[model samples]
Target chain A: MIAAAEPIEPAPSAGAPIDEAEALRRLRQNEDQSAQYYAAWWLGRMRSRNPEAITLLCQALGQRQPRQAEAGVEHNAVARNAARALGKLGQAEAIPHLLQALDDPDDGLREAAARSLGELRAMEAVPVLCTRLASGPDVAGAPQTASSRLQEPCEAMLEALGEIGLAEPRLLAVIESFVAHERPLIRSAACRALLQLTDDSHWGQQLLALLEHPQLQVRRAALMDLGAAGWRPALEPIRRTLAENSLKLMALRGLVENPAGPHATRLDEETTALLAVMDELL
Target chain B: MLSPNPMAAEPTELIRALRQADSPMGLLLATRQLAEACHPGAAPSLVEVLGFNNPGAAVAAVDGLIALGEQAVEPLLANLDDHNYGARAWAVRALAGIGDVRGLELLESALACDIGPSVRRAAARGLGQLRLDALPRSEQTRLRQRCLDALLAGGGDGEWVVRYAVAVGLEQLLLGMDRAEPGHRSGLKALQELAGEPGDDTPVVRLRAGLALSRLAGGAGG
Candidate 1:
């Protein structure tokens, strides 16, 4: 008979398993570029609230190492990912540093910073972001080779504004113009933003129409967009979308419920309607 | 009546350590040791350690209280300190982890609006796993609906982690409910929504909700 295998330990994560202390050390010391990058992701992923971790991440926002693959571009992947982590760490202290990063020459880092500020819901960053958005997606330093989405932080800026909820009519008008942008990605993202900013079903209708677009990727993105829009009319369209169960269910729920709202002891009308729709799927 | 046990009167190592503890480090050491001795006698000291303002010691104390199971619920309740937010947070977590239905009201309140994400997450997970069978048959349905309501409300929690925990709680609540009930239909619909696209921004939340929905289906198949 074959010998029974002994159970030892669970497999390690894709990134090497480093304890909190080690992650902090690697991040603070800039042990190596690779080590530093992984450490930044880890500290944020682990939700480490260490003041030292926050300070190191903030410092990393300015570590401008040029991308070797694209030698001419001075964008730092390390700083970009570091900005992403700081947002996840939920420290308000990083907000000022992130705002400073918003004006960085590297649009990639700027995008990451915008995303983090949105995640932080930095209300203060709104006017700054609006100014940047007003400047348009084609900033002066952007590389011509990359697509509009990759070349600028416009898409990310709009998404962040939506996350923070834009009330300024000037910024809203800028986002509204992007609804007619040539790129499908930008157009879809604009619709999502408009929905959040305006809470208008017109944006939701545009999102539903995008759900029927030729590309599968655009449809998927619209499904997510519609979900975040929380427009009541999007529910039926989301259910009918040719997507997997996970996406369908998520979009439907967002239409009826706002996660940040007060505790629900009883089912509201929207929730009742949601259940009625779900009954058909069941 | 059953005969009383003399062993209950003997001082366990946890109590002895608590008496000997003179410093913060000593208290942590005592609390850590209490993890080894999971007895009803250690419950009070474990509850006391929650107010130590030491996360390490407090974590150990919470684990010890949880390990004491249903027995620790009373002391945790009686010692509820309204003034100390940290202690209350830790205590709420411990009570939720214990899943002894007696912690229902606390779990509901914590899930509703506790400032600490971790506390709310614990409450969400705790509310779902309450031992409904422990209640009288006549009362089980009402209690189950109460749990379902809290978990459903928790589904809207802003923090993805709390919402993820809410998915877990909902799945557990679903497991306890009969498939034909109106509550089960609403609860299951909420789970489906959590699993849906753009429903939760975090992939982890969506994945967990999807996994929860899958588990419920698998359980039904069995």
Candidate 2:
């Protein structure tokens, strides 16, 4: 009995265990630069874990930075992280601050904002993402210390909206425009996003047409999407493009998944033939 | 030959280990092996690894990030400026494999600055693989020039495989240009003459001369 001493109570879960109000107050008043940074970050993280905290952060994000504003609020890694947290939280209220962040001169800040807008799945941000995509990567200012990678966040944002399966007309229009962007990578991303959105009618046909995109990647993505949609029309054209082993493998895989028996058999034959070529090359 | 099946008896252990792996390489190898076997559970862990501390480890985490292919692009792109050329090269190669072009501009930059000729060559091949040649003439020229310069720099002593690669790239550049421009004309002619006598002297010289011929032919065609 003595050895069995009462079991200790389990520690509180990380979620909402402490006094949120107290923490927020402390976070608001902490004068230490790093402390303020951590506070803002935790606030954002907490907001992400619980939607209730979103409105509060939204208001705080909207408030003008203190007199040290030029020091750059969002550039603070914490602020950037917070913006990303808000993006994950997906509250519409965070849109404006996130958009303002898009204009922030800091590439990191702008990127964080772009990523958050995407995670929120806010279709309203579609126009902004499109504009940025069109602008391409920021190559000016600050001796260009940063690489062109900041543009990936906006690309992610675009993908997020597509993956959310939102059917907003403007969103679709923006996605369509991206498909033709001067940046091949952006166009490829747009194609992938469009694939995420499978509208059996219009979107499906457009994706099917992309089978002919000059870029093999766009074509591969389109074929994959068509397969995902179980579109039968993809069989013939996909069969024709079997020149590429990778693409052919994808087309064959799609046929196997979707079940066009005769078409699948044909693909199997082509696949086998392609394997012979590949084996010889290998 | 490891398997990827999640329903296997040791699946739970593997999954747990995957979540805690310290290095991305370990995580990637385990996940890839698990995937080959039959386990789909490695996906999330793989995706999580993309956010790892080391850029190389982060890149190793990519093949398993299909759940967020597009989502992973930016993180991967950000790594292109990594202090270690290997890390930057790995990131560029991975983005190209992801083949989304979201990082094409970044890759284009890498083709110019990254130290190793192999890395630059990979970037060039990736652009061609992605058909970025179809981009505007200006962008195309930039990409082509980088590829040409890299092919020429790689040297003829490397390997026939490398030599063949340089020749292919020279051909690609010749085929990619507007053909009417003076630059294109000079480049194609230089490439054709180089390709004429395939006897390997210095791979760099042969490649460079071949690339010039290709550009010359391209310009003449235009």
Candidate 3:
């Protein structure tokens, strides 16, 4: 059996500050702490959006902590934080390291990587994110089991991809695939992303199909996406969902955002029906 | 039937690379499903997860254990003191699912002292679940008082889910009281007021209140 990871050893003690030259020398020497702190400081600088900062951060990311996987310097928080900060910097240069960190045994480290990939809008990270979608939480080998620490960052990447926009064919396929993702969060994330990218494309049909998703919450997400995308074709599903008494009011609200068309008359009917039950809330 | 080593052919992959899973996330996904499949045998895994610092994993483990029934009692009780409020609260709910008398007194004690309103409500609920079977009639009075205290303490929760759980738990305890007794007469009235209050109108709360009211009606009519 390929057992799960052994406990990681702590990194070396905090040391005196080193100059960029000294840090570069230490990194080459395989001293974990020197490289780790240098990397963290570099990534932090990168997030500042200054040209000099971006250069420094990119340099840190390019350098490898070869000892990271070898000497088991896995508990190197500074090194891990640096990797995360690089991801957040959103530079295309950071993609490889960020992708590498996604496999981190540490949940926080993996998420930081995920977020960085998302923030940078690293389109190359899409394949990795897509793989994460399929991993589900079940696989022991996957970092989905790492910790709660990664959940938000993983979700963040999906959300970012949605807001970043995608082109046709591939965009529709990604949306269609994610609609079937086992995790509700991922499915919803994919739906939201698809909605953001919808235009003359056939995304309206995909969103309509998602309305029948097994998870009612996913259906709600699809409804919201359609409403936001102005996919007028979705009015029927949205209206149908709003009419169901057991469904949440938020879903109903999402469907009736426009309050016009078939929606105009249906909204009144649904409101009248819900009013009797939601009177106090209204 | 699924094989025990579902992902045997696939090597474990890195978390970051899970996106391009060599076996298509097969190994990672197999492990999660395997946890659920471990079912009757997964008790130990779930118990061990209670100590995990990761709230997500702990929550998953607890949910698995709760699904396993009475066998999860000892380990869950040990986790009642978990550092995370969510873990402790989930533990309390799992204990309620067990609904054993051994946990009744512990839950009652928890109501008076637990820091988080969610945990307090969960403990109160554990007591409520045990109401018909374990609680001695003499202890019922104190249970009523402690539950009401929790309702008052948990009144202003930012997460309406917690307040709703507390409200429903309060109502359950109230309904269980000996309404025929003059001292218990006002308990039902308090529950009725709390049930209709706008604060408890969330779908989750409304569902709980609906269930609680149904129980109360059954008690009154029976």
Worst 10 residues of 1 chain A by lDDT: A1-10
- Range of the 10 consecutive residues with the lowest summed lDDT in candidate 1 chain B: B1-10
Give per-residue CA lDDT, model 1, range A134-169, as digits (tens). Answer: 655444224347453355567788888888985778
lDDT for every model? 0.73, 0.50, 0.51
The clash count for each model shown is 5, 33, 16
Instruction: Output the lDDT of residue A63, model 3.
Output: 47
DockQ of each: 0.02, 0.01, 0.02
Candidate 2: regions farther than 4 A off: A1-23, A44-52, A59-74, A134-146, A150-153, A163-188, A198-282, B1-222
TM-score (C-alpha) between model 1 and the true structure? 0.53
What TM-score does the predicted chain A of each candidate obtain versus native chain A? 0.82, 0.47, 0.43
- How does candidate 1 score on lDDT? 0.73
TM-score per candidate: 0.53, 0.33, 0.39
In candidate 2 the C-alpha lDDT for residue A38 amounts to 52
Give the alpha carbon lDDT tens digit for every residue of B1-222 in model 2: 233344655456766766776764576566555444344544444444444443334433444443234555665554444544444444555565555646666656655555544355445545544455347867766656655555455323233323433454555555655666445554454455455676454333343344334344444311
Better of 2 and 3 by TM-score: 3
**Index of the highest-TM-score prediction:** 1
- Comparing 1 with 3 on TM-score, the higher-scoring candidate is 1
Q: Model 1: per-residue lDDT, tens digit, B1-222?
A: 112232554447557877688875687788877755666777888898888665557767887887777888999999987766667767887887778888999889988977666567668878887877767865888888898898899888767667877887887788888897668999988988888866677654665676668778983211
User: Considering lDDT, which of the candidate structures 1 and 3 is the better prediction for this target?
Assistant: 1
Tens-digit per-residue lDDT, A1-282, candidate 3: 001111122234544544545544544444566565654654354354544444454444444443456544555455465666665655576677677777655555665566667667677767666665544433422233545333334445555566455555654564556556556555555655665665543555666666776544556556555544444455556555411211222333333343323444232345333322321111
lDDT of 2 at B78: 45
